[model samples]
Target: MKLELLITRDAWQTQVAVLEDGLLVEFQQEPRHLDGLVGNLYLGRVSRVLPGMESAFVDVGLDRDGFLYEGDMGPLPDLADADGIEGKFRNPSIRDLKEGSGILVQVTKEPMGAKGARLSTQISLPGSYVIYLPFMEHVGVSRKISGGERARLKEIVRRLKARVSGGFIIRTAAEGVAEEDLALEMQGLLDQWALIRLRGQRAEPPAVLHQEADLVARLIREVLLRADGEVLTDDAEAAEQARDLLSSMGHPREKVHLWPGKPGSLFEHFRIQEEIDKALRARVWLRSGGCIVIQSTEALVAIDVNSGRFTGKRSLEETAFAINMEAVDEIVRQIRLRGLGGILVIDFIDMTKKAHREALFARLREALERDRAKSRILNISEFGLVEMTRKRSRRNLERVMTGVCPCCEGRGRLPAPWRTAQMIAETLSGRHAPKKAVVTASQEVVRFIEENRDRYAFPSGISFEAAETPRLSHFTIRPAS
Candidate 1:
């Protein structure tokens, strides 16, 4: 499988589109000014503690207060019991985190809509091979690294961790790495944490102690750890920076390539703009004439699958199974590409056979396994519906690309022009009739009102004069003296 990271930088924003085999799989948009806040470390002060919610609101110098859950406070036993307290509950109450208490925290989730960012006090700094945990004192291997390799790597970390001052979670990239290299990476993370700790101590509350790397560097370090094909960038400076970063880390700098396209943008040359436009639409069509309608609301996302025009050569059961299976692939791709999160309920073409439902459910899970964001899938229900939730760090692609409709005010529909005219007529009739009433609206609506003036039952004392305006379904009535 060939994978490419296509980077596009403009004055407005920098976009990273992950393409697998020339198909857009994942896309991220980062504005030039405000980068994402997921991994930022802050010295925060507790603003309020809600005992009922088991969470505390912390002032982290953002527009909204960061949310600190009870679980994120870390193990209380490790805080107190490690020093000899016994039988004490490990989870402390939120009330214990009183207002004005300063604490070190890192953003785990980005702020979305009205909610603030999610924070954790169990600070962790991530490196290429290891994630440093300052407060803990053990080594853990990534679950993805299995068999004897996991045991071997864990032993290596255990032996080398004594040289460092903190715990380390061996990342997936460390599966076959040398012990010396792993130790070096662990020490780098520890050094970073030490600096962050010093900054946190000296900095005032609600100050940023550490900021994450930029998008290009971070993509190389975190996501595109093994660039199977190449990382293509339109900007020369960005390409050079990526090459330098990879070269400094001893990775292959040859994988970072500059796009050769001239006159036209890289995304335009790759035809990515067409795919992006398709992603923003509500309906998606599959190769076999099946379709999926994805609708998003404030609460959750609902997807309905349909076998549009493709009639199979076989039985009804076979056709339903085939179309449902196809829908699963597209649904998973859409969820990842669009960054859909929160509660997602998918309505598949109802299948009667229990085995078929199980097969589809399993396929859904396997397809979503490639997704980097954490997600959980529930078993297919008797009603042939599957429910799931993907972890949401920042706003989804749709929310970021588009805003609430101005005319409809996000209702997705506007009032009819005739209805608006009637309301205008009613308001004018209720008031003391003037010699002339001026009605302002769009050209079409004004013509409609003028042609249907007799039907409106407007008072004879008022003569209606239509004034053209650009509004679709809006108008105003005023007396013309």
Candidate 2:
């Protein structure tokens, strides 16, 4: 499969599209002014420690305080009890800290909605080939790198651990990397961590110690460096910067290409904008005439699969299985494209055959394996529902591209015309009914009242007036002259 990265940079923001086999699989956008906060390190002062919640709020110099849970405070030191037994370990608690105490924390998740940024004391510095864990002591390799290569990388990292101060996680890009290269990157990260600590010690509380790299550099390190791909960008300056970054990372700079296409036409040229528009919609139609309706609520996302127009020339069980199997691919694709996270409930058409259900579950698991975000999929329940969860670090595409609908107040529906008519009738039939009253409402509501005139015993002096309004439920009954 051919993999490519399409980067479009403008004054407002930068957009990146990842295509596999000429199809868009993932998309990301980063604003020029407000880069993401994830991976940033700050020296924060604890402002509030809530022992009841087992969490604390640290003043990180942001609009809102960063939230730190006890579990994310890193590995606890083994404290001995009165018996002084060596094997016993004490769990860390939030009560150990007091207000106004200083803590060096890293942002693990960005501030979402009304919530503050999620912070962790266990910091990990990501490099091109390896991630340096300053607090962790274990050496591990990427699960994607398997067989003999995994053993080789593990052996290399274990040997390098003797020289480095902290643990190391071998990235997938380091699968075939030489031991010397890994050692070089590991040293670089260790030096970086040292600088962060020195800065935190010298700086005042609530000060920023380190900021993550820009979007381009992060993309190269995390995405392009891991795969064999051509990086095409419309911005000449960005292209040069990408080449320089790749060269600094010990990779060939030739992979970065300058696209001579029209300015602001890169995404349009690749039809990525169309794909993005489609992803924002609730209903997605599959090639086999099956469709999936995705609705995101405050608590979880619900996806319903329907056999729209495709009627299989097979048994009932076969048709249900076919639609579900096809829906799995689209569901996974949409999930990644939209960057959906948190709890997700998938409702698939029911199939009676146990074998078919098992096969469907297997296919879904296989498809989700390609997703970069960490996800957990539960076995399909007897009601043919699949419950899953995906890690969400940043805002999804829909939230970024669109705002809540003001007309419906984000409910996506309006009051029915008949319902509005009932409200108008109730006002007109009040005990202090006006001798002369005018009912003003949207054209639909007015028409409903006029058509169902016999249904309501409104005051004889009342008159109906249709007016243009944004909401059908908006109506007013005022005394007329």
Candidate 3:
């Protein structure tokens, strides 16, 4: 499969599109004003420690305090280990932290809605080939790399572990990487961590010690390097940066291609914007005429599949199976493209046969294997429902691209004209009703009242006036001059 990375950067924002086999599968955009906070390291001051909740709030110099849970405090030294008899490690309790105490923490999840940033004391610095765990003792390899390659990478890390002070998780990209390259990257991460620690020691509490790389550099390191893809960008500065990064990483600088098209045209030429618009909508139509409707709430995301128009030339069971199999592919694609996370419940078409249900579940799990986000999917139930949870570090695409409807206040529904009329009638019938009242409302509401004058007992002293208002459900009533 061929992979391509297209980047568009302007003064407003930077958009990155990852295409697999010339089809968009993942999209990300970072606005200039709103820099992402995840992966940042900070020397935070403990503002409050709630022993009852086993958590603490840390002031990280952000708009909101970062949350620190007990589990994220890493393996604390066990009291029983005072004698150094190889005692087991224990998780630190929230009571161990005092108010106004300073701690070094890293942001694991960005702030979403009312929640502050999720933080952890276990800091892990990621590189192109490995993730350096400065405090962890475990040296692991990516589960994707197996057989001799996995063993080889593990052995390489173990051999070099004696020289370094931290653990390493060899990434899939390190499967065929040489020992020298791994050693170099490992040392670089160690040096980086050393500097972060040094800076944290000297900095005051609630100070930022390290900030994560910008979106373009992050995607290049995390995505482009793993896929060995060509990077296309219209911005000369970004193109030059990509070339320099690739060259430093021992890759060909030519992989960073400077597109001749005008700024923002690269996405249009590849029809990426069309895909993005489709992702924003609730319903996504499959090639087979089947569709999936995705709805997100505060708690979880719900996906429902419907076999719209395609009536397969087979038995009912076969038809259901065909549509469901196709739905699985699109569902996985949508999940990645939209950057959906948190709990997801999928309501597939009910399949009676156990064999068919198992096959569908297996296909879905396989398709989601390519997703970078870590997810756990359960087996499909008898009612053809699948429940899964994906790790979320940042806001999803819809939340990033759209805002709550001001008129509906995110309810996705508006007050009916009849409802508005009823409110108007109630106001007019009050004992203190104005002797001469001028009511202003939306055109729809005003037309409803004018057309249905007999339905409502509006006082003769009251008159209705139409005004174009952005808030459809809003209206005003004032004493007429």
lDDT of each: 0.80, 0.86, 0.87
- Residues 1-481 of candidate 3 have per-residue lDDT tens digits of 7889999988999889999889899998888786678899888999999999989999999999999998888754222233331234446678878899877789999888788999998778999899998767789988888999889889988998786566899987787889999999998988887677667657788899888888888988888877668999988988999998888778899898888977778999999989999999999999999899999998999999998988889788889899999999899999999989999999999889988898898899899887889999998887789999999988788888899888998989999998988998898888988978999999999999999999998878889889988887778889998
Predict model 2's lDDT versus the native. Answer: 0.86
**TM-score of each prediction:** 0.90, 0.92, 0.94
In candidate 2, stretches whose alpha carbon ends up further than 4 angstroms from where it belongs are 75-91, 431-433
Off by over 4 Å in 3: 33-35, 75-91
Candidate 2 residue lDDT tens string, 154-189 = 998898887555688988888788888888888888
Pick the TM-score winner.
Answer: 3
Better TM-score candidate (1, 3): 3
Please rank every candidate by TM-score, starting with the best. Answer: 3, 2, 1
lDDT of 1 by residue, 1-481 (tens): 6888899898878888888777788888788997778889888889998889999999999999999998887633222123221213334567667699776788988887789999987778888788887767778887678999999899988988775555888877677788888878877776786676567556778899889887777777766763345799889888999898877666798988888887238989888878888999999999999899999998999999998997988988899999999888789889989989889999999889888988998899888876777899899888888999898876788877888787787888778878888777777766465647666677667788778877887666555445654457777667766
Candidate 1 vs candidate 2: the lDDT winner is: 2
Q: What are the clashing pairs of model 3? A: none
For candidate 3, give the lDDT of residue 58.
Answer: 97
The number of clashing residue pairs in model 2 is 0
